[model samples]
Target: MTDTDWGELAQHWLDRLADCSVPGAGVTRLPFTPEHRRALGVLTELMEEAGLVVRLDAAGTLIGRLGGPESAPALLMGSHQDSVREGGAYDGIMGVVLPVLALMKLRHDEVTLPFAVEVLAFADEEGVRFPSALMGPRALAGTFDMATLDLHDSDGITLRRAMEEFGLNPDSLPDLKRNPTQVLGWVEIHLEQGPVLESAGLNIGIVTGICGIERHMVTLTGKAAHAGTVPMHLRNDALAGAAELTLATETLAHETDGLLATVGALHVRPGVVNAVPGEVSLTLEIRALNDALRECAGAAITHTARDIATRRGLSLDIARTYAQGATTCSSKSIEHLCKAVATGSRSEVRRLVSGATHDTSAMAELCSVGMVFTACRDGISHHPSELVSEKAMTAGIQTLEQYLIQLQ
Candidate 1:
């Protein structure tokens, strides 16, 4: 038995964390800012109350460590502390609080974990202020690119300078790389950020893997002509080509087994009522749990777009902008989580793949990674309306604590 006032504690802690944000409608805690510092203060209190030793890593990742038996590797938990501007209260921070509360519940029940546990509040995950993200997890995984330190924020502050001002030694970030041998695994509990779980009438779901993502910047060029003077046959409109390509991408996704493609942004040149569009640019993104599937679709869409351009007498340029391979949750981790789910819920664990990225993807480079997706209201996220019920929070805490107890 435990004294768990789930809604009260979580809601109160979330309120306190929300208050640490800048003056805004939703929480606006960016890394290395006053809001981040204030929220860390609150987390420190929670960590201390849970009987853990707290410290901040060189990259500003706030870590709370709970020791295990001698020579045991640590099981890393928690999520990012920062948020997008006017973002939801529970996006990243809830993952941090729920784990600490799980530890607190274990302590209250006199339950001790067999392996070392660490609650990590990563400094930046949203990349809202900077052009790069996943600094903490990537550093720990030894996959961090040192050149990113030179990247500048909106205010012209270099990441290196911001780290220095935040009392962190940027030079030591590489030194903070976690040894694979010293880490048991990593688990992140976060809002579903999608409607899958909510639509299923479930509060929690186990992640099968994180989708691989790729983006291409596409440009189409054609001659601009007077709309009234040039007939449709004579006009080589770039916007028309772009429209065809967008539909092609959509059709490709719809026909494919697992691919999800989008023309998320588009721009037209020579804005005028009379002039024909001269040029067009857009972003084409494809995501899938299978890298082969994603890459295949990307190739197909690119080829189709090029053909469309040639037929219309338009020139096209497509450049790959970003690519991250898909990451699958370890079978061992899935087995353990299944057992944990049996401990708390009657229904079988619902397994799903995440279309969006998370810190778990980066941590996979260091050790095995798993995720628990807590359903949010109407699957809304990255906005102020994000909501996770206290009942769901309590269920998550129970399962996480059981996970610690059930780990082999």
Candidate 2:
């Protein structure tokens, strides 16, 4: 296929994948759902059309393999197929499609390599369905915690039960761990999910690393009282304290370099407008490529929240819900990806740290990992407005194919 055709195919497949979502504004193909099953069917057909042997692993990772020689350590490339709640079409799915198209182009050309190639469609990365995300990569890396199987989702379904319902034996998860020595490194093609590339007028970039993430689940306690009867000064309002903390976090992020602080979720109790909100629950998320910076920002947010609660006569309860340390990409992999992009674009490839976590972070534990990023519109992602142009995708496929050829 020509470059233009590759781009067209990437976009077409993305549109089809988007349709395998809940009837909503954006894609919502969570792991183990009917939509996920439908998407698997579509992907399986495409993988087979590219002349690959396919299988869904015990961890629910859909893999497509192109054989090389006997006992050869295969070069793995892929991304997750799952989407966040109402997330954009390209966020996770594009990573899976771009590599498939690259392999298709290679197969069309009848190019043979010394090393086997495998494209992986990881089942979960967004942690939307279950709090314990990155199941597929971690399981493959042999880092999966069996205890997480008991974790429940919104509908009270355990992770183990979900896997069982999906026709996967939960007992087989441990056996799915791969031998790192027999495996080549992992390369993930993903959207930049930021404005750096677009601002720099570049179509592609290389990832330096995945940022560390920490989430704070906070609750402020105050007395619930009648909104009309209680005077503003006398009422201990938890929502007011939460509002103050939110602004404080925003200011901290703005002031600190390399720090990203967001109060993405907030819930007010006794939700009725007429009732003075006596209790509030909120989530404070902190991220940074530097672990020290992330920790410092998180500490600052905690201090700020505590102060807000104390000054407002409200009690504060804070718990750490999630913590993932930063992960640097393989230096060799970055050089290889950059060389390919530089060859394709006839210019330098931009390099940036991914503020958002990815399956690559989990995959890194299994093997050396690298990532190539395509530009997204206005640096938006995980939203309905997120977009990547066909031209950009075409460039992405070409880059991946060249990288594969060069790797061989």
Clashes of each: 0, 0
Against the true structure, candidate 2 has what lDDT? 0.90
Candidate 1 yields a Cα-based lDDT of 0.91
Q: List per-prediction Cα lDDT, in the order shown.
A: 0.91, 0.90
TM-score for candidate 1, please give it: 0.98
Question: What lDDT score goes with residue 302 in model 1?
Answer: 85
Tens-digit lDDT track for model 1 on 135-171?
9999999999999999999899999999899999999
Candidate 1, superposed: residue stretches over 4 Å from native: 1-4
- Candidate 2 lDDT over 335-356, as tens digits, reads 9889999887666689999988
TM-score against native, each model: 0.98, 0.91
RMSD of 2: 2.5
Superposed by TM-score, candidate 2 places the C-alpha of residue 178 at a distance from the truth, in angstroms, of 0.8
